[model samples]
Target: MPESATLPSATTKLEYLRKDLEDLRYYLDEFSAFLPL
Candidate 1:
């Protein structure tokens, strides 16, 4: 099997996942701010 077929695509997917997680955290924080403790 070729190495290029496996590695580069996974890195791209990881980067996308990280961005999505960051956005989710940001929204969660915003929602938390509106709630009474």
Candidate 2:
């Protein structure tokens, strides 16, 4: 309900999302290099 209380959870969620996106990009890059486009 309070903005202060919700900030940490939002930050943690963003961090997780960022890490997942980074991992996906890394794998995609590796896969793309082996495939012709």
Candidate lDDT (C-alpha), each: 0.94, 0.98
Range of the 10 consecutive residues with the lowest summed lDDT in candidate 1: 1-10
- Which ten contiguous residues of candidate 2 have the minimum total lDDT? 1-10
Residue 21, candidate 1: how far off, in angstroms? 0.4
User: TM-score of each candidate?
Assistant: 0.78, 0.86
lDDT of 1: 0.94
Model 2 misplaced stretches (Cα beyond 4 Å):
none
Clash pairs (backbone) in predicted model 2: none
Clashes per candidate (backbone, < 3 Å): 0, 0
Q: Please list the residue runs of candidate 1 whose C-alpha ends up more than 4 Å from where it truly belongs after superposition.
A: none
RMSD of each: 1.4, 1.4
- Write candidate 2's Cα lDDT for 1-37 as tens digits: 6999999999999999999999999999999999998
